[model samples]
Target: MVDRNSPIPIYYQLKLHFKQQMKSGLLQPGDRLPTEMKLCRQLGISRAPVRQALTELAREGFIYRRPGQGTFVAPESAARLSQRTTIRILTYYDVLWMASLEQAVHHWNFSHPEQEVDLTVTMCPRSEFHQVLRRAVAKGEAPDMVPLDYVWITNYARAGYIVPLDTLDALWTRILREDLEPVVAHHNTVDGKLYGLPTQADVTGMWYRRDWFAKEGLTPPETWDAWLALLDHFSSPGMRQRWGHRYAGAFPIGTAAGEATLNLLLPFVWVAGGELLDEKGNLALDTPALRRALRFLQQITLERRAALPPQMASYRWWNICRLLGRGITPMTLGGTYEWPRIREESEWTDEADAVAHLGFVPVPRPSLDAPPVSSLGGTSWVILQQSPAREVCLEILKLVVLPENLAAFCGDGLQISAYRSLNRRLATTPEHPWLAKVIPLLSLARSRPLLSDYPQVSRFLQKMLEQVLWVGAPLEETVRQTAQALALLLEY
Candidate 1:
């Protein structure tokens, strides 16, 4: 009964068909099922999906294969399914969220002794997580759960690789929807259904040396003009001699920086009143605001010579933080998530010392009357459709998102909680000074465009920025061509 035209893969459909048969008692324990060749012929499909279906069935404890005989139903398969389930998970940067998962697993096993579940976790490199995950899904070997970037949620949801939470448990989904922050909720929902649960939140902004700013009788820039004025002052021979600084400021502006380039620069477009998509979800990249933003960046880096052009293109995302921490630059663009690393690199004695020396601000606007802007960035937990233990995975996620667990994770990571209630608590908590400082700015944060093709779109935007600021290409034509390329990409 596999639908060839359905978004779901044929192998998955075949697996579901056999699973239904077993559940309905049509295929009982010790019953031999059809061979792979026979099933392919009967289902009018190729042998690859049939073989994959059988492989998954065996792995999920639903069926058993003999060396020379044939495949048969697993003995007491239905009765044993819940008792001996092992959920597999894939994650990266196994830090705060991974610890929470471990705790959730322990709690689940302790509370539900009759239905204890084991866990198998695989850690991947952060830079290659998305590509590796996509390959796994394509091969029908996806893990049961993954901590996915919020922007990529739509891609997985639309491709039928992940199931909608509402379809599995509507009540739990409704409760989660009501509990998440509005922006976080917006990023996790695709086509009116929630698909992922965010674990933490972060905002992109600039980090400046508070001590140095005060010493120079200067404040954080409030407008683009003021920002350029500060850069001009800092880049002068007198200021460099006085402060022993090497650069006026720094931020990533090259393709090598990857998504970090967008994290740091997209706010400029927002502050200029530019959007990547219109209200109706059409491409809106070719705008005066974008051109203005790009021109400003080009003027500072290429024309004015405040930030070195060749160095800017070669800098990694974390290099800016390192420059700021080492007192090499007066100011640098970064995210709140980098606080711990920055603090460590600076060798600040403690949180109080770090706060006394450092100051964080949203990206400055184009004019005095304009509002500052920031981009929201975070990771969320999502269940893959290939998971045979969706219910069990949901149970673990529920425990992971408990108020105390979320607080602990965000507190240790120095990140904002996606839950508004916890954020309110963090705002008043004195021990978490960094969170208290940045929580108020959450209102100014906006998520990047949530599209299945966002990875490609982001690449185009990165290339466009590099083309102008680093490669010295004409700004208008570059932006226009990139916009056209993006439109064509989305068209098909």
Candidate 2:
């Protein structure tokens, strides 16, 4: 309700009211709000206050006005900011980040009564994080605290977008505990400096259906042949969810473009005993390993017939979720975030078991001699060069990365705990059942190559993958074409 008597402006009060409703479950994504006429009738306010409220809400991204559909609630990401000085969190959208970040912000506010950290949302796609982050820092409007994916820390570090954590040396040291192998810590660093703190993690996996497996008399796949047999068994043209695999739908599935493509492609790469990247992260795209990886997905999605829904040709990460949720497909190739939704029934039944029927494992490599691999997924926290409270903000990162709080994040949402000490804690979430299978799989977790030209590479790969997947091109020919394009991009 608008507090007409409060010193705060009525429209802003209304905006906050809507925001709180969103946060508290009073409203939901895509839910519609009252029309101007209806709002005036209910509030006993004139068109003036009602219109003002609508304008403010729309500006804050709380509501979207359709030509004839009236105003509807935007995704929570849209309305989470309003410009005050709370710890502004501009990163990928994840509930785990919210749970822990809000807690950290609360602690910061409580610990320092004199200072305030107002938070805002800058919901960005995974691939866009570094680009937007650098732009924000260059413009002096960077988020006070921004989470990044560790694979790209060096790229951002190279751009001078990250603030040093050395100012919070002791606290930083605790956050990056020695218990974690220096190799793991190395991902969140650049040039021997810890510029960011990794939070949760996921690697690539073949998310499949336990129900389907049991019904079809299949076991969890252990080799490329077993995986192929399962695909052959489940794939039929008329079944609603044929052969069941989905790719990245909301964000691009692979990062490092081809570097990230390994997450999706590595199972095949490893199975064939191929190495896709050398130690320095150059594409070994022509190797038998690379050929096997490309051929596997190409066959799964097209030739062998166990593929994403016909529509998934255009799917990104979220689209995969939506398609799976809607029962268009049964299996997915995705991150561990699916744990929260896997057991619950889809819209068909209020039960998650009926809906998602979830199971995930690192897809088997070609042979036992080769270790199965999955790419790490999820985001991390980084300091911003442009923050006014750069020093204090680094302190907040220390606070957020603490085990107790980070575990709390891992327990709730898509966030995977990043610290080594917290891995066991994260393993205990009986609530996130799919996680039981998810964590052991993390041992094979490798990150996408930390390429400097990631965005360009990602764009090119997406374009090329679409070309190969959609245009019916031969994998070998496609690789050569991709190599040529990449060579051109590198030359420039």
Candidate 3:
């Protein structure tokens, strides 16, 4: 029915009409929505309102469109249409490890069939996440819950897009406080409010081929000097020819912006004792430690005689892992997140083959006396401010964070769970011997600054690295300029 005389906007009116139909069960799952042309004719209105209504509905999870096919009622929406309470979740998907997350949701659904839930999984690039989420929020279509990178929580919280869980339930809060790893607990608490729940944790390190090391009669390097020597040894021209590989190591210092490159580099800065910001909350890039780290990187990367190839300047972080797996590079700076993929793709298919050939270690120290450092990695689950079902969302989050479920999810993804008890349990299991090596490294793990401007700051660091490695910019000048940019970004 066209409300020609009503003061409400045509699109709003049309949206209400369709929503009422859906809520009343007039529309069922798999039911096709009318085409824009048909909707226009049926409502006696122009295509503009019809299109707007459809777009909003789609964003709200009322419907979905399949390529080369028509729009259909979303299964989750159809099931939830008549329910008194419904909670919606938005999550990211990557072919590598998203299956565990889905499995968790399935477990929840199976255990709680009376509850209605809708999940929207997006596989968009990480760079586009904020944009997509912001648009949905602006359109009044934000989901009840979402999984966010720990670094993004501060920004979202500051902007009022998400709510602090501290005031929700004292018992639940205490459970999280007791179970979450200290590093993750600290990261999720922004300005004294707990805004997100840590789901997993990761520690960055190096993956090398054990067989190659043994063939060369060498052991994994334990110090920075030894590491450099090892890189040079494997990259020798004779060794390259003999091994039939072109690159000795893969270190992603690509000019293209990505979180992976930043993650791979941050630990180096920490080990050198370089901080992105100082006690005054100002940029602190131009330091002796940073200079030392960059020079070493230049020696191993940008120099013509270096072990790593020049083309590494264009490779993404995962590309380095793939190269290592394919044996194109004997070693690569990577983390446990890529372990499953490497195991699946490498020639080592059995445990004996794997232990004899493939291996990993904490990023080497500057010297035997210096301590090793690993950058803390992984994400947290956030409840948005716009969520109508806050209580329900909290319950769902609790289920997701249960120690057993968290362990399963993190173990499957080859990640470190943020639960200290779960990690301690994994450390005891002989089946995953790598966990013993990795769990100890978590003590040395450092998190990136949870500032609202960190994304910009990280990009600035990447740009500075690219300038030194690719553009041949003067190290001191480039770092000074980058520090200035970081200060300006943080100022506003």
Candidate with maximal TM-score:
3
Measured by C-alpha RMSD in angstroms, how accurate is candidate 3? Answer: 11.9
Using all chains and alpha carbons, the TM-scores for the candidates as numbered come to 0.77, 0.73, 0.78
lDDT of each: 0.80, 0.61, 0.72
Number of the top-ranking candidate, with lDDT as the measure: 1
Off by over 4 Å in 1: 1-87, 93-96, 109-127, 237-244, 306-310
Candidate 3 local lDDT, 318-360, one digit each (tens)? 5675677668888888776766546434544333455677777
Cα deviation at 201, candidate 3, in Å, is 0.7
Q: Which candidate model has the greater lDDT, 1 or 3?
A: 1
Task: Give the local distance difference test score of model 2.
Answer: 0.61
Q: For each candidate, C-alpha RMSD in Å?
A: 15.3, 9.8, 11.9
- Residue 21 in model 3: shift from native, Å? 27
What is the TM-score (0 to 1) of candidate 2?
Answer: 0.73
Any residue pairs clashing in model 3, and if so which? none
Model 2 regions more than 4 Å off = 1-84, 93-96, 124-131, 181-183, 237-262, 279-281, 305-307, 340-356, 428-434
- lDDT by residue (1-492, candidate 1, tens digit) is 887544334565676678778867788999999898898688776665577568657755678899999999988765543355688888764233555676577577658878878666666655677888889988999999998878889988998988899998999889888988899999999999999988888888888899999988999987888888888889899988998889988888888777889878999999988998898998798899888888887778787665443487867666676678778888888887776446434656345766788888999888977787899988888999998889889988999899987886677556788889999999899998877898888898998988888888988998888888888999888988998899999999
lDDT, residue 88, model 3? 64
Model 1 root-mean-square deviation: 15.3
